[model samples]
Target: MKLIYVFFFFCIINQTYGQQKELELIHNCQGRLSGFATVKVIDKRDSSGKQMIGIVQKGALNKPVKVVFNGELTDSLAAFFIDQSANSNPLPLVLILNELFISEAIDNMTEIGRFRLSLRLFIGKQSDQYSEIVAIDSLYTVKGLDVTKKLLRSISEQFCKISQLAAEKQPILDTDAEKYTFKQLHYLDSLEKMKLPMYQTDHPSVGLYKNYKEFKQNTPGVTAELSIEERKNGFRVYIWDEKRKNKTKLPSTGLYAVSDGTTLLRATPLGFFKILKKGGDFYYWRPQVNKSHHSLVPAAYMYGALGGLVYGLIEAASAGNNKWLLQKINYRKGSAAPVSWTTAKEN
Candidate 1:
């Protein structure tokens, strides 16, 4: 019994050590592209159809390798190429590329037999040049042309769906045109200066203004105002007439009002108003407004739907490849083999 207990304890220690080592390896492995090569796509369906070519880069990450496509195509097709470039915001093309390459690497590493690779190809009907994703095996042989073609077709269909949805939910100006009016009284009790109108009652709510005097001095066409008031309930705050004519009313109640100069209003559930002013005229504005149609939830959903469709198209395209080509290459499933090389070439 003593010997058996000792053996079990040793096994547990070894298992824990192995798990820790695996976790460290995965955490430290930075995905880096080591090499890249170009491959041409042959059109078996349409012998005279325009040919597609793309470059595939090898990387350490067990994901689909980067495949860049560029060629003559229509405006819409051309836009996809532009979208692939890095931008201020997240680009759908970049996301798609990342998903395709990452998923491919994962699938390859797992040795999953029933995995699919899709690559969406954007093409213009009038252009001779087209973009595509090229899948190469360990031997650097092309094995994913047919799958890419099918994926492109699916992506085109999904794009049409998203376009239709956008047309239906086109933002309307009147949707945000509701106006609010608030009034308050201010009494001046100072003995120093005789009050012309002993007490002036201006809606404390109206006192709300954006302070942008410094901004106006530094940046042309930039102004801000702030209207503050002491009311019976508490302090009333309003930030009015910023660059975009945005108005925010903060009262003692939990509810807050936010509006653009002319239209577009929002109410928040939070009672506290915190404003962070940055730069000359640019300020980060957060307001509590009514839960209305233009709320963040609806906008997020719209973007998510469109994003999902794009992702789906790219995933579908990654799966396309000519069966003839795959067979000729004798493509076999296996994880990306570890590559080791020194950086002496760079020196």
Candidate 2:
């Protein structure tokens, strides 16, 4: 019994030692945020399905620990900005944190951290929102022996930098923000709805859609000879170069979706998805499975419907004010249907 007890004790110690540690984000702002008196942050990351703000390596085993905000991310962010905007002045700001993800990897014994943060800055409070002044969707990478610490420091710096950029937006700040009445807001909303291009289902335009706006407009930016090439992992869009008499792989950075008049494939953060069905205010899509590619990356990366900025725009356009509410694009795994879109949350 004593032997068993000792073994159990040792096991407990090992488990405790190996357990991943969580780090709280500490904001170290060098300067104050000018022009904004108060700050409010709206947490919109629930839709992305990625709750972990960052991951850090801890202990001798270098176990990957999930880094989280001490309290709510929104609260932390708001506090960070409010602390920076201590003596701030005229406008109240609303920061809608769309996505915040940090990933860590060890390359050649050097720790590397990658951060992708997406946020939109509104001129007023959440309920009494004035107008979106700035949108920042950016990716940052840092490499060091203590990459996690460096990454955190970088994030803190970014908080200050973002605030400075917001301060420099003189066009909006100089105008009468209070004069932005509901009638003007309605007019703007109506104008956006009018900008939503009609999707002609009968004869949908064929080719590469640079953005959702292009797709809605039914005018593909790239009408070149393009095809979906099956890759070792999944599928990629390739455009045939008539001059070269060869096909060039189209980079997925700016491309939104590609249609062949018969099938519509939407681009998510992960890969392209074959849109299976379109229903009321929602479009269903599943990952394009390659039978030959047995080893596929986990579907977690492909969870979000659209990328950062695009998703934000889509959400705004799909609100009740807009005539088009085709908000969600579902993506599901294993099932006959497409995988669910991470951004398919109800408003």
Candidate 3:
């Protein structure tokens, strides 16, 4: 009995020790996002699809906000990033919202009949000089203001999702992070050669949406979208249209490989996931998974989603006439910090 107790105690201690290492890694890697920001929402874009000008609405569209890494600090995974060569903004991060705004020709103006939405994040200090964009999304929307409402409602959840992805892509193995000084422009290029793909599964491996428009063209009014890709070291991406029972390949791997490729957004398999009846974003493969469904999300996504849900519920109960319900949090190029060498370990 004494030996058995000693063995269990050691096991528990080891578990806590591993978590502590991760907590400290990201803390030093991100240096804790400096509190500074501004909000901007573009209403229109030019011929080149560049943001023209936007009016800040009432919601969480403001900045200089406080962002928690999903749950407690202990929840943070040990992740590191390359740092900026030059000193720029303290901690620069930007969130962009894109809309397709498809409309019929009115008397003189265009009215939106169908609208497609896309979300991207820019992380870095000298954004112009060095920055990374992570496209985090699930289903494409064709709804109108519901888009904004849903965006607002799920802002915190999205933020948590983003934060968690950033953390997981962090080196599964502990890295000094300091040694990788001098920002490398083609960090993602290494992914193609990094043995197994970042995401753990075979379908909808992490990256970006290459043929989103193509898939949408084939199946208009897509309620939800689930992307799929093989988990080989090469670039192979695909998105499945559940309604049409179709599979289309993306022209290129979706977005740049952010978060070391373990990003929950990229890790989640493509499928129409039903928000589970248990409340919150808890979803499963009941109606949507008839052997066709891929992985909805990884363990990381579920963790972040829970944080988002907790945040969402609070906002719904308390949100009044406020627009900036979302906190202003962002990351920058070479903004990650180095992990302590002594504590670093191989997963």
Q: lDDT per residue, candidate 1, 134-249, as tens digits?
A: 22222121224123333333333333432233223312224243211111001111211132111121112222122222111222132335454534322355666557477676
Q: Which residue pairs in candidate 2 have backbone atoms (N, alpha carbon, C) closer than 3 angstroms, thus clashing? A: 285-338, 286-338, 286-339, 331-339, 331-340, 331-341, 332-338, 332-339, 332-340
Q: What is the C-alpha lDDT of each candidate?
A: 0.24, 0.54, 0.27
Clashes of 2: 9
Write the number of the candidate with greater TM-score, choosing between 2 and 3: 2
Tell me the spans in candidate 2 whose CA falls farther than 4 Å from its real position: 1-23, 33-36, 48-50, 55-65, 83-87, 106-110, 125-129, 164-204, 210-218, 224-256, 266-347
Best by TM-score: 2
Report the C-alpha lDDT of model 3 over 69-122, residue by residue, as the tens digit: 234221221111222434322444443443222111111111112222344444
- The per-prediction tally of clashing pairs is 44, 9, 27
Q: Write the per-residue lDDT of candidate 2 for residues 1-347, one digit (tens) a residue.
A: 44553454344335533344454656665654555667767664443333456556554224345565555667767765563345674667777665566656665556778777777776753345476778777778998766767776677777778877787774355445543433344334234435444332445677888866676676899787677755544568777777748988767666777876766666766676555443212253333211211111111123222222232343344232211112233111111211122223222
Give the distance in Å from residue 18's predicted Cα in candidate 2 to where it truly belongs: 10
Q: Which ranges of candidate 3 are over 4 A from the true structure?
A: 1-89, 100-117, 140-152, 163-347
lDDT of predicted model 3: 0.27
**Native RMSD of candidate 3 (Å):** 23.4
